[model samples]
Target: MIEPAARPRATAAWLLLALLAAAAYLLGLGGQHIPKNGDESVYMHIARLTAGTGQWLPLQSEIEGLARNTKPPLLFWQAMVAGSWGEAWSLWRLRLPSYLYTLASALLVGALAARLVARPGANDAPRPPLQVAALAVLVYLAFFSTYRYSRPYLTSAPETFWMFAPFFAIAWSPARVLGSRLGFPLLAGVALGIACLYKSFALVLPVALALGACYQVAGPRGRGLFVLRRAGFWSDVGRVLLAAIVATALFALWFVVDPAPAEVWREFVVGENAGKFNARESYLGKALAGSGSIWGLIPGYAVNAGLLMPVVVGLLFAAWRARSGADASERVLWLWLLVLLLVFMLPSQRSARYLVAAMPALAVLMVLHWPRIARGWFIATLLMALLATLFALNVALGVQALEPSAGGYSAGLWLWLLAMAAACVAGLVKDGWTRPVAALISAAFYVAFAWVTAPLEGPAGRYDDAVIERLRGEAVMVPSNFNGDFERYQFLLPGARIEHYFAAQPVDFDGLPALLAGHRFVIVQRRVGQPPCADERAEACRVVAARWDIRSRQTNAEIRASLLRAPQDFWFAREYLVERLAAAEGRP
Candidate 1:
């Protein structure tokens, strides 16, 4: 018979998950700032232009220049619908869907982790019925990366969802029968297909799942080569392939109804994913040229996941308790996790963000061991969560609060209270270390949601007030300080015409004047690794100042240049002809 504890645990899990989602939604609605990433700006522009024409196209040919068919239409189509509401909508509003996807992604992680812990041989098996579920929620909630990106408007959120959903479905395979097995894998296929539509690396997820299954079923056959001759292998492979085909068909449904369906598909799938992956050189140079291996941005990943060390410790402890009891199926969980981590770390092409795809597995690992950890460890985790909550509060209140009383929210305060509340829950659930840990996790999620919900500085805060003041109502040639800065200027200063140049490549000295024509205001800033033209007699773009440290100097120069151009309205135009040319042809 089902245990009574299961009902309460499940209820708590659902309720907490709902609460977290609500907080994310509220934060998204409140005065949250959109990321000022270059790719975001590019996407926004594409969306705007698509809305205008009722067809996807680059907004300003000279500015955006890329073929509109390059990226798959799913996200662009979403953005187009969003842009139809009007450009007057706030950036945060435009990014609302991404925020929703992020929250959904987080909840899925919680669910997957819980499922893993509920498996028969898991260390939490003999514990109270809801123990594993509560622990899963805690493990998921405490992850910093999950919290950080949970509020951002980016394809990564959707991509993350698609990538992990398949794994979750696959992990739950034993719960169903043979023909029914295809159900989860099919859904997994569709999710992966959508993920592929977002980013090419998405293919890795389904492939990893396949590899994981192979590794698991390969007892005497062998890890790498045994699958080649197995009878069940072809059947399994066929099902997965069918799922992939179905996923492709679902993805094609949108474009199939569009005017240039075939063209769009080819460009999106082949040109964007295949092109980007195969292309050895970037806009700067070879992608591998300047890239050096670092210990793979793990700290950044940790912070993003919201301080996950406790979860790791819990997972280890749980594993230790279940070591002797673990069965073949239980062992598959560890192997799958190992496969996920290996894939994430494989990309000598590393970024903290890349680790997101494997996050669900990490959460599962944490939850699997939640039952056996010591009470002291659970207490330590709660205190640490509270500390993080406090730090977030200070940043939001002390720093972000200084700006215009951002839309009726104080993310920091909310987050702090959340942490404190979790601490209280932990104290109450003092049955064993697991109960306390679960409570602490609940509290941590609340804290993170509160902290993120609070209105904070986005890319817009980086602008110079003086420059904003000076450029009011003036046509200007703006610096490509970052992607969204100029777009922000468009809103801040009505009637300001802008010819913005990104600093991705060296500028051609010839095209400066025509690019700046009919514009009186100018803003210039140094690009990373590119210092100002040292020559005092420089004729094209003059140095705004001698120096002002490093990153700060660029902003200072941009402000100074805007000031210098304020009087004559004849600001110097920096050349970016080369950079423009490179991206135009889809260099990187």
Candidate 2:
């Protein structure tokens, strides 16, 4: 977003750095502590189970109440192909598609942003297309929502790419869709349908709404607010309708292809899609109150930007100030964003994630208004990244100290952290460097997070090879606080019949082993310093192997203690793979 103070080479370097950092951000994506929803493992569980069946129809799931049709089959298929149909199943393999999809979308965003700015309307002064385009890619990748959901075997990346593609095309050249009645509409419909197949059918509404808005204010009618002529308006409406119908028809393929069409209708179309309408007591009341309120959702655009939230605030101000002067193309981007927001506002289950598809448009808008935005926003972003950098280093230190066996942080890893610290400092000081630094800072934090958890993928994070082989074809009870969280064991201890125990339940350290009775081999958790077998005579358990884990969902007190005092005590825990010597084969 910054005009190069000197040479374009520096800008190119920053772009390359941002791209590499983006890749590095997802380095340990499959680990336990990445920022993601519980749905990830659930989706993975379904995909793995479905992959085992070797048939595409009727998406599989072990999660009760939300069987076969919890989500569309496409995401499962994606995970299946990525994981090699359960033969080479690993969290990283399952999540690779998500990373690729996100990267593709970011590339499209950069090219579109450069195109939008290169034209006469968006920029205040002439800037190189390459510079603006590279910065846009960095900005899109820097988004917190993109960082959180764009990887980790989730549908966010594919849905974002497919759903936003049509808009990107329209914004790139309005005449393509608006010029031909059926050509663009049909193609756009196919794209939206695929997106719906990845995510949910409910998304079709927003896609349709955004497409309608884009067409209404595009071409000859773009300069003014309305189409004015009755025939022209009807023509546009018909085109939008055709697109929506096509998208819905593609979604209907699920019902047609699946063996149990009736179940797909009931479980997915009714339960998943229609169930969102089951609102609270009063629609307006709920809209005005609670965490799900319309007010909370209003600033979703900024919220999605995470550390770059301030930059978005500046973008909003800049857009408002230049509202009167903005061109049709710029306004089209605005309409797509606004329409998505308003359409999703109607749903009972409103989340910022619903607006992620429109994020590429947001990235374009950010690039167009970048020069006008305040430098203070960049400073704010650098400060946040600086804080995250410290956390990364501190946690890495803690993790390293805990595991002397896992080769301590490599030189390359240490250098990466050092570079992050340096970038944060430079961004805060020099205004010229701030934009590029802000762009890569989020990815830096992602890398830091990955580094902190990277050891988990090593010996310290996994059981001994011999122990893993011993557990194969045997029952292994693991801790699961959420639906499908135990799916992690599929990769951690493969070929084992894994069952879940409520590890989140309050621990009775004295009787922890007794609590895991009836299973031959059980994975039990205890505080880092707490003894795994405090009551040895109880036949509670015999620790066969152990691994380190940064306990998830720590209390606020624990978090503060982690930073202020001993990191191991409050943040880390030990998971023991113990043998229950005297218990029968009971299940919880």
Candidate 3:
């Protein structure tokens, strides 16, 4: 345990790490290939298309099938405003709002943690809330999900902010917010409505369930049982019902305002939301089986933490151990987490990402029980960070070996990696330093990743201005093996229309030219050292420009090789922009 006299110094160190974690998130904001959800480009597509139309009522997208209006317009509107309707567009600028939202959510998480924790016993000197709050914020940012999902111009950060804002308020002042019949609930509804606009109106069910359950818990306590009249049950019911109505009404505004209400209903409501509860598979079977099973979701909070999963397990046991005399406000948070898990189970389509909005509660609970959690969890996190930093350092050194001509990551990045390794070593050896160092290493690892990938978003990995200029109005056939991935070309090649063909790993090299038969300009991917075109097809197409790329999807063999041998070969690729000289006239 940290001595009382030195606790302030310890808290200061945590506060510094919190600031570092916050700043790290912004360092490589504009990268073409950074850690992010696959749908980031898809969301960017809708936002760009909607901005092109000069209206926000109906969300626009060029994506075919049910993906056109898969989500409401708030996220699109955010991108439009951020990009200045495409006048001053950049990936960094577009992603800035999500970062801000993430920062705000972190602040709220810290605040909730600070509030939920009770004062230390009279025997101990008064401890600063700053210490716990800063750790909470650091832990939240250190989450791999926070890094993966929050940084992209996606729904996760903003939706997490608006959706969790109500709980933050309720936790901050349970007496006032929970007691209010209409005031707080109205605001909560609007907040949730905004969240729904970013995600789906289906979220209202979970949010409402959480709200009502919290209200019930806030009611007069009498022997762990509910007496309707004494518990103010009807008033609490009114609160939940009113909030649900407001949220639903606000979401329905899409239909009221959009030019194509029927399209919105069919595409968004039915295909996007209602499709989750399919009659083809029994709900119980869906819950119990396959990759999307509820079992996967049960441990999501920890899994989302990535390196700190052990700490989450420790936090869970700590919560269980402290359940008997827990604070009511804290119980509200537990109820919120429970409600999310329960409601999401009903949908046949379940994902760990859906549990993200509950992470703030997890952060608070961890902070409240930080001391109670066994030290082994913290040690495990430090060990994982040590291994990851070692791996990244190896990759960095190997990158130099692979491409000596192109300078690898800078000295500062090497030093950063070394620093994380050193800190992990120190934490592993010392009990008192373990927790704070665990957070620093987790956050540091993300920064290291961003620094290493920074060059990919720079001149070295991208096509020169000349290539982007020539391909302005042309149709370029690009390969896409994942959802909305080819949409990345809209930014890469500014006025070009991108067409896609499936090109998964073990790329069909023999069929490369056929893919470019109709299009004058096309992009093809090949592993480094491979020829741009097969010998027989050399005359069919000519390589105009080539740029470095990363093969994000890898086979098991590639993963094994990356882990055991040459990672640079498996991770890096060369993307060629080819012109079909064989085509008679290739405008179409």
Candidate 4:
């Protein structure tokens, strides 16, 4: 048992961990710009519509002919609440809830660690429960996915929290409430229900597996037969059923209450959920064949977890080495990790984010076995840190050689690189406190890396408020053939009315004059090696406003050629603001 005096220190350690998470997730949050992608914009648009419409049932968007019922109403509701709190709607305000969710996830991990470590069967010989818990929090905060997706208005952070909440809840339930009743299991069901409301019914698989694993391990000799023999086992089974029923009922509420159930059924149930799994080209397949393949997930996982993947491997190896002696809690955690991996791997739409549901369990297991794996962990930490420093220096050198004025190659970046190098050296020197020190240093490195290298929308040159201002309150025509660039336009010019042409039909230059009869402005892409005006009919429109150095929407072959031909030149599209001179002049 933990001593009375040690409790305060443990509390302090938890507080410190919370502070580190807050700093990592919340600091410089508003300063960084949103990515130039449709995902972020799409959510933002839905949120804006939610706030404007206040109906909140259908999950609509501002863009015409677009209805988004793919995701549930929880995130959109959170975004609406966030939008209302601040005076003006900003990306930071929209994303504030995600930061809080991320912090809560870290706290939950820490709490779960504390619980497991304090248990009688935990391997606490190598380190104290408090120390292990602290390391777990650090590991979570330093994860590459935590750093990347934690600050965005994405579903990963909340989904990760809700899915893992039931495990801890069920574990701590028997102690908090009376046995053979509907206390903890019911609560676990509610947590699962909330997760379903947040994402989808897919979460049910892992939750069921975790609860089943817990039941199996809770029995004598970790056997399923013994668990089946117990009277309380049936009660536990009832509780799990209760949880699933509750989760299912809550999810069904959407279908019951929504104004357009058919749309939800078609869009969400079929398009998003069913379509994702049935697709022949899985995300994993695309990764392996298109870009890097199966090996890519390694670096992807490492980078997402703050380059502590080697430590994860070491912990796994250590756990395997000592598997014969693992206690109930360790077995449960391993089962949780395995179940998540198995369920996620079966789906075609695999991503690193999909594996985030298992990270908290992985962090706890790693900390539990840290003492046995300290040497390997330390060595891996140093090697990763060294590699990171070398890579940073190489990139800095490359930027200095190619573009001396590049934003990333600055004095501040150099200082951060040196600081990372110093921390790695300190970890190598400090023998007794190496693990904690490495955790602290690695967390700091990721925090610094995030703040220093956070991508800004201004650098992309995709959206210019000034250019957008020119078209404010005016109807703008966009080619339906252009991918999702129009979403960016809608984001920039929220007040401007937008209409799509050639949506169902092919682009006909002869019909340009008739299409521009009523519209004064049309946004079109000017591809490289193509004339500004494609044909004679297009000559009626003259360029009124153009933003150079914007990324081009072209095929891979063209992009590759452009990169090869003009290595130094910015490979961006020149966005043309074409005005129909005839229409503007009211000519016949």
The number of the candidate with the highest lDDT is 3
TM-score of 4: 0.76
Go through the candidates in order and give each one's C-alpha lDDT. Answer: 0.51, 0.80, 0.82, 0.64
Question: TM-scores of the models, in the given order?
Answer: 0.65, 0.93, 0.94, 0.76
Off by over 4 Å in 4: 1-18, 31-38, 62-67, 85-87, 119-131, 173-180, 219-233, 279-306, 389-410, 426-437, 453-469, 475-494, 497-588
Candidate 3, which ten residues in sequence have the lowest lDDT sum? 118-127
Q: What are the candidates' C-alpha RMSDs?
A: 10.2, 3.2, 2.6, 6.2
Which of candidates 1 and 3 reaches a greater TM-score? Answer: 3
Measured on C-alpha atoms, candidate 3 has an lDDT of 0.82
Candidate 4 global lDDT: 0.64
Q: Model 3 off-target regions past 4 Å?
A: 1-9, 118-126, 220-224, 227-229, 405-407, 534-539, 582-588
Better of 1 and 3 by lDDT: 3
Flag the better candidate by TM-score, 3 or 4: 3
Error of 3 at 138 (Å): 0.5
Candidate 3: tens digits of C-alpha lDDT, residues 165-245: 998888777887787767898999999998998899999999998988887776433223644665577777788889999
| C-alpha lDDT of residue 169 in model 3 | 87
- lDDT string for model 1 (6-49, tens) is 76765576566546534644543433242223466566655655
Q: Pick by TM-score: which candidate is best?
A: 3
Which pairs in model 3 have colliding backbones?
none
RMSD of 2: 3.2
When summed lDDT is taken over every stretch of 10 residues in candidate 1, the lowest stretch is 544-553
